[model samples]
Target: MTNPLKKYGDARKERIDQLAAMSDGSVAVADAGTIEEAPGVSLIASAWRRLRRNPVFLTGLTITTLFIFLAVFARVIAPHDPAIGYLLDKVRPQSNPIPGPEPGFPLGADNVGRDFFSRLIVGSQQTLIVGVFATLFGLTGGLILGILAGATSGWVDSLVMRAVDVMLSIPSLLLALSISALAPRPSQWTLIIAIATVQVPVFARLLRGTMLQQRSSDHVLAARALGIKRSSIVFRHMVPNALGPVIVQATIVLATSIIDAAALSFLGLGNPDDRQPEWGQMLGQAQQFIYDDPHLAFYPAACIIIVALGFTLMGESLREALDPKSRR
Candidate 1:
């Protein structure tokens, strides 16, 4: 019947094919350099290049990298056996003994004669372990509690927020001390749990406020209008978008977590085994000898300070980098 509609469809198809062919030819002629200028690749590459240019970020990154490496390779890097005490050279300060010294003494020795250097290295392991686990536990607990509270307002939100407020009112150190004392000995699991509990309320309040702000955004309204499941929208869309601040906060929390764990260990509420050469234990055992061989306390204390500062700097750098207002 020589239909007009059939002819129009065939003409459109031919035009599309011609356009596609022209596009392919253009692409081929543009060369590899042109193709490499794709938006996603250039954006990531530019960000990486910019990151390399920032001196503060680079310095923080280097310090953080070294600590992470040491934390991972503590056992292998440690020179002297952490557990073994060099009793023959006990309480020897930084001052070297006679020229032909017996067994070459290190920065003195701890109360039990453990190598202070070795103990410091080993302590990194416990500090890293507790910090990572406790931060994860607290972050997860906070996210869940926050979502539940914010997603459903009214009495549920009030109750959850008030509970967080109560937790926040108590001093973190005291709360940790009471909890550690009441609970079983500070095994890895117990310490992790204790630190997590103490830190969770802070994260909860932070996340709840962020989530509440997000809940009223246009995208959230659109999602609701489109009949998207509330759970999927909150967990997938909302949470991911609001994660920038949370991630920055988490890093700072990690630093604080390490300090808290060390404090607990120093107070003797940490790991049960006395043989384990934790930093805090070394410092605690060095109390009497502070005057005799200050290095005994100072060495471990210095290690803690350095590691904590590294984390703090990294967190600050990350927050600065991620925040648009901060950049301006």
Candidate 2:
């Protein structure tokens, strides 16, 4: 018969070996309770699972993806020069202001006699640039204001919020138009900056609200107790965790950015260069010939509407997916 003490010692050694095999100790924590259980699905991972199953999100993703592909491949895919009226002979006489679809030109001719199809294809690049850059600039501005207010709190938060409120009080479109009108001359950059300025208040307000919640979270409390620097607690801990809602808001803001950029261009505050085609500028130029050729105005208008719709749908679906209350 084996000694009882030796049997107990053997069992204990077996358990230790099993634990050593299972865990490499690669995942570190300041304390054992800091990570009591094994890692599970993260917030972003869980939200993505929901979003993939959402039809609204998929539809928007398809539309947005196709739009981006077109913009990126404009030069490669466009059959004709967007700036050149290469098929002037194909266009009907001055008796007809714009021509309908033909053999090579599917969308026919624009007001200036350029191939409307090529212009539409190429104009996507310009529209994409405006939407992305304006949103990025606005997001950067918002992040700055939000971080300052959310981390500092007290008087800083109040002052920042009040300023944001002042901006919000004015009509958003009107605010954008006022800024665009300030430029010495109309250009794509000017339009982007104007739209970005208008968007800053919305993003700042949303991020600040989210960040404020993170300030009192349990993890933050733990970090403080660990004697981490206040800056590290704010930037390293609080800021990263608080970005989920802000990311969701950015998607919605992208849709608005596109529409606002178009509106600015439509108002003759967009790029003045005829060499570079843009949907909004195309639509603006076509408005004069609406009765003579409604299709010209129709095409660009439809593109803007559809693109904006896609972003809105994606943003809404993503918001629902990320909402803690709706988690599956």
Candidate 3:
């Protein structure tokens, strides 16, 4: 009897050839406009087209760009020195005071009479820095671990996955807090590392799962059958294909990292200097006079919320765009 599997494969190949021939005939009869619109549209290009039309994506992109600009030009744009405060004003009686939105101080002054607007402008730099670096650290670590686990099998995969599981078992905030506690002093780098440590297992697990799915796909199997090096097959074929979810996750993680960093700072695990104009530290200080000057708390809290919202909107939009079901 003829081999069943070989016969099935031959039949499948013949069917594919017939489909190709049909497609060619259809293309030949198609209008020029239809052909032009169909051929050049790649996955990324199609996604971009979809994103451009999405109002949520546009809003997020605008807000994110504005924050980035504010972070970059903080020093040039800030009206006054953020560190200096009006001690003279602080010395005055509590009943009589210089109120907010005063001349030269658009957003008014903090409890110590520091320019609230300037502090907010400068604070964006520190907040963005922490979010960005922490995300980078986490993404880098996760990519390495995910690739190692997904590309291998048996003991190697088990070992890496077990470590990921252990990390995941811990509450993220608690894990970050524990790590930050180990630092001798509250520092920016310490906060970044702590947040990043919490984030690694998340990204690693996501990428590893995606890679596992991709590895058994026809393209990966073909590459392996072609005698491609294992490293090339994994990196060149597997990683790139699995990166869509990772990129989307990175944006969401960035927002979380910023919030986590702010929480760390609020808990007094930030810079030792009270004068530093980080948003979380500012909020920490404002809590003492919350009833007295709610705006002090409001401004920083608003900034944090707006920034995080921007990242979240963008991440969600990207997720929708990348989803195959959404395309259909």
lDDT of candidate 1 vs native? 0.77
For model 3, what is the error of residue 151's alpha carbon versus the real structure, in angstroms, after optimal superposition?
0.7
Assess every candidate by TM-score: 0.79, 0.86, 0.86
Pairs that clash in candidate 2? none
Write the number of the candidate with greater TM-score, choosing between 1 and 3.
3
Q: Compared with the true structure, what per-residue lDDT tens digits does model 2 show for residues 147-220?
A: 98888968988999999999999998999999999999999999999999998998899888888889889999
lDDT of each: 0.77, 0.88, 0.88
Tens-digit lDDT track of model 1 for 1-328: 7989999999987887776677746554325356354445543354456667777667767877888899899999987777787653543445532112135445444555556666778778877888899999999998888777877899999999999999999999898888888875567677778889988898888888888888999999999999999998998777877777788889888889988988888888888786666777667777876775677778788878877787787777777667666752
lDDT of 3 by residue, 58-172 (tens): 9999999999999999999999989888433653446634346767878777666778888899999999999999999999999999998988889999999999999999999
Better of 1 and 2 by lDDT: 2
Q: What lDDT does candidate 1 reach at residue 174?
A: 90
Candidate 2 Cα errors over 4 Å, as ranges? 1-39, 89-94
Can you list the residue pairs that collide in candidate 3? none
